[model samples]
Target: MESGPAIFAGAAFTLFGAALLLWTGVRARQGEPVALGVAPRAAVALTTLFGACFLLLGIWCFGRL
Candidate 1:
């Protein structure tokens, strides 16, 4: 596997997860629910999972490099 691809994928996931969390925060501050589709807890859980995956992938990529 190429370290470049892994790094890029990890970065993408991290960015997406961060964006989701930030969006949720903004919505919550405005008195809106954290999730627009699913339950707020579910959305937060997914976001947390994605963030963890991204962090692990990034660490692995760095080690490979």
Candidate 2:
């Protein structure tokens, strides 16, 4: 695998995941919906899960490089 593309993708995933996680936290703190029309708890859980998965995948990609 090319280091340049891997690095770019890894960075993108990491940033996106971090944004999702941070957004969820900020919205939860303000009593806003983490996802529109979804239950607060479920939305938070789902968003967090996705964020974690993305973060892990990014880390894995970076490790490969």
Candidate 3:
């Protein structure tokens, strides 16, 4: 409920998503197949969507400040 906690949570989520996406990028470049038990292309798509969602959620949290 506090601003500080909210900001921390948002930052954590944003960082996690960014890291996940970055890993995906590396894997794709290496031509590795399957991520999270799925196809490479699907993995990329899911990670992209989840990463965007994380960014949006973080922005929403920050906006409350």
Choose the strongest candidate by lDDT.
2
Clash counts for all predictions? 0, 0, 0
Residue-wise lDDT of candidate 1 within 16-58, one digit each (tens)?
6567667766775686766578887787677667756665665
Q: Against the hidden reference, what TM-scores do the models get?
A: 0.57, 0.94, 0.79
Distance from true location, Cα of 34 in model 3, Å: 4.6
**Residue range 1-65, candidate 3, lDDT tens digits:** 49898889788877877777777788888988637678778888888889778877877777877
lDDT of 2 by residue, 1-65 (tens): 49999999899999899898999899999998888888889999999999999988889889988
In model 1, the worst 10-residue window by lDDT is 54-63
The order by descending lDDT is: 2, 3, 1
Model 2 worst lDDT run, 10 consecutive residues: 31-40
TM-score between model 1 and native: 0.57
Report the number of backbone clashes for model 2: 0
Which structure is stronger by TM-score: 2 or 3? 2
